[model samples]
Target: MRHAILITAYTDFFHLIDLTNSFNEDFDIYIHIDKNIYVSPICLKILQSFPRVKSAEQVFHVNWGGRKHVDAILWLCKQALSLSTDAEYFHLISGTDLLVKDLQQFCNFFDKRKGTNFLEYFLLPYQGWESGGLNRLQYKHPLDQLNIKELHDRNVYNRFVNWQITSRRTRPLPNYPIYGGSSWWSLTRDTVNYIYQNYNQNGWYDRLEDTFIPEEMFIQTLLLNSPLKESIVPYNLRYIQWEHKHGSIPAILDEEDIPKILHSCALFARKTDSRISKKLINYFNNNRSSNL
Candidate 1:
């Protein structure tokens, strides 16, 4: 079966080289680079060297607490899916992500599975809130306070909407608890096609991106509600530890962390730097080949 990796990149491309060189899987690699960043000659050369790596065009500028992340993802998915007609699985990866398992083991694990979709689920702690169950912790942006009708109605006049909707007075509307997890996942072609065709075909796109752009809710809700929910693995293979109180991104992996990463029973990890971790890649390659 065909497999593809989709990496979203903004500025720093150092980690990307590590991922590209380490992945032994004979799968297509696609990258979505933020259009705003200027690509240096080294970055361009590295990208062009890999015949399997295809550039995803029409990228948008994304923000931390904005809908740009969701928008860029949607656009990237469209581009990747278009080129990956024969692909059985599409692995959505961040630029800072690294492959823990070699190509053969990774292939074997997924090949043994019957269903295609793989994702993780965790509870969203927004049920008790007064803002209708929209989790503020997950999204720092106070989208709930925005006047939905007014914001939607305005073209460019109401762009500067602040202080008008106070968070102190706003409250949660009492929706059921949302199951959320990591924004990254691996999706089957059938499931993705179903989502693009049926659910997202309506105005749900804008609603998801702009209104309450919770990373976990939108995809989890749609997938669980779909007829193909039974096909979901409910266990994405990436192993990450987010124990810190204010942890947003995973810690950058170094040479010392290689041993723990090897035996983690995970397929991938994130936030590995390119300059500091050549030994980790070599170790992975050696161990992976031996295992095969």
Candidate 2:
């Protein structure tokens, strides 16, 4: 069965090259680069040179915890679906992610579960998020207009959130249940088509315009509240570390973490760095022929 690897990336072009190289003819790669960053021309040329790779014609300046991130993902999904209508599955991942499994093993795993949607999700009022995560949707978060990397902008955003909280100002929740989870996932073509169709027909796109980190909630919420809910598998099949270390959350994977990554059932691992993950990347590259 053919697969579409849809990627949303801003940095680490070399790692992205390694990622795309891992797949074979059975997969078509679609990438959406964050328009805010200046990518080297050589990097873009090299990426486009790949036989099965396609860079998105429409790009967005994605901001963290903003609606634009969700928009970019949806755009990537749209691009992939439109171009590869026959692909059976589409896997969403970041540029820094490395495949932990060989192409054969990865395809085999999905081949056996033809219709399953693999993602990490939990219903709202989840303890993992602040105020049960309702605050994200209940307040106006103008993250798209503000650069989170700027100290002044971050301060302004924080004060705005605090003011909204103190004043008890909140918008009404959507009429349906809200679900949240990791942004990455593996979905069947049918499920993705359903999301695209429903999102456009329903008013969800406008409704989520100012929601915080809607990327994590948009797809999960849409699927869980529909007939396709039964096809969802709770695991997203990606290994990610949540522990904060070296000043990074979802701690950057390194050579030392190879054992844990290999032991996990994840098909891929994320948040890798070109500098920190050189050994880890080399390990996988050297052993690409193996079934690990």
Candidate 3:
């Protein structure tokens, strides 16, 4: 019943520590810290100190809506696959994510469904996205190389997108239908191996490099088109709120959200903060046994 937790983190070292501590010996944690942020040597050493924890030797800048995010994820997957061959499941999650389920509960959930792949997905031309999400792949996205948070850079990015749209410039769509959703997922070892093998052999890496937020689409599109699609459960097992708050897309969870979070069948919840989620984290810590 071994599991691998693959994490991509940028800030908040203390929260990251708590995240790793949540899992027991049955889990191996693989982490990739964003290279753009400065992390103290002691912090890095402390993270690596955990017996089953391994930090990625190679790091990436990990810009938002960038291919580097996807690259970081793939790199983590590669590291986990190479190091933890006996792991039955790999759970891709963020550093801000917290395990809502106890260790036994988490393992039991996955053990009962041995071959299932859990991810949230929707086909292309989804009404929720502008241009039905086609613009993400149909047009060239040079902004991926720049920081979208900077005012000057964001303006340039917006101008490029507008110009492309006005000029009717679009790259030819790939032959396969596109699918996308929340990037976090729990996948079986066989599915992960297939993704790694197929991605390397089919040259999807280069094709996805210039697309916007390819991380959300790459795995979904790849798996949905393959035989493994049948095994996909279509729920990523993470409870997340999409409302914009605290300057992020998914609102950071707080104590106010505790009831819903506890009630949900989700194994984890994301975008928590040490400061904002103090009460929520403490509740879990104090009530660990009762919650289970």
Candidate 4:
């Protein structure tokens, strides 16, 4: 079965080269680079060498904690789905994540468990969530961009209008139980298609368009509420360490984390900066060679 690596990248081109090269040609890559990033000729050459790597011509200027971030993922998903109608699954990963296992191994794992989605999720209003994560569903803003002029355009009335109008969510609470999880997931093409269709056809995306960090909620809630929940494996297949509580970024993984990464049984590990740890790369190379 073919897999699509749907990546949302902003920086580190060589790292991206390392990432894309690691996966064989069988797995097509669909990437959405940040609009602000300029791709150098050499980087473009490297990416072009991969026959299946497709980059967006009109990349989105994604903003953290905003709907644009969700937009980026959706854009990549659309491209990936278009890449191949028969692509079995799409694994949402970042540029910072590296494959810990060989593609053959990963395929074997997925093939054995065909029809099951490796998506980690939890029913929302869980422990440690302030307001039971309800604020993520209630509020919507204009989503100020990074430009000074854009940010300055906000006024009291705009804020009031956003809060007053966006606060009134049309999606009935408890009827559709909200779900939460990490941004990365591996789901079937049908599941991803379902999300894209539901997002457009239903009012859930509009309700979440202004909500803070809606990426973690919008897709998860839909999956949990759908019949596909029975096919979920409950593991994201990625090993990422959230060292800092309430931290927006995962800690940069190093050689020291290699053992734990190897032990986690995850197909990939996140935030692994190759510059920080060549040893980690060597570890993967050595281990992957042995597995081969």
Superposed Cα RMSD, model 2:
1.4
lDDT of each: 0.64, 0.88, 0.86, 0.76
2 against 3, candidate with superior lDDT: 2
Weakest 10 consecutive residues of candidate 4 by summed lDDT: 144-153
In TM-score terms, candidate 3 sits at 0.96
Q: Candidate 4: global Cα-lDDT?
A: 0.76
Candidate structures ordered by lDDT, highest first: 2, 3, 4, 1
Give the clashing pairs for model 4.
Answer: none
Better of 1 and 3 by lDDT: 3
Weakest lDDT window of 10 consecutive positions for candidate 3? 200-209
Model 1 backbone overlap count? 7
RMSD after CA superposition, every candidate = 6.1, 1.4, 1.5, 3.9
How well does candidate 4 match the true structure, expressed as C-alpha RMSD? Answer: 3.9
The residue pairs in collision within model 2 are none
- Candidate 2: lDDT of 154? 94
TM-score of each: 0.77, 0.96, 0.96, 0.85
- Tens digit per residue, CA lDDT, model 3, 1-292: 9999999998888998888888779999999998888888888888899998965443788778889988888898898899998999999999899888877788989889999999899999899877898788888786568788788889988898889989998898877788989999999999888888887435566878678988888999889988998999889999999998667779888898899998899988888999988998888766665755
Error of 4 at 37 (Å): 2.6
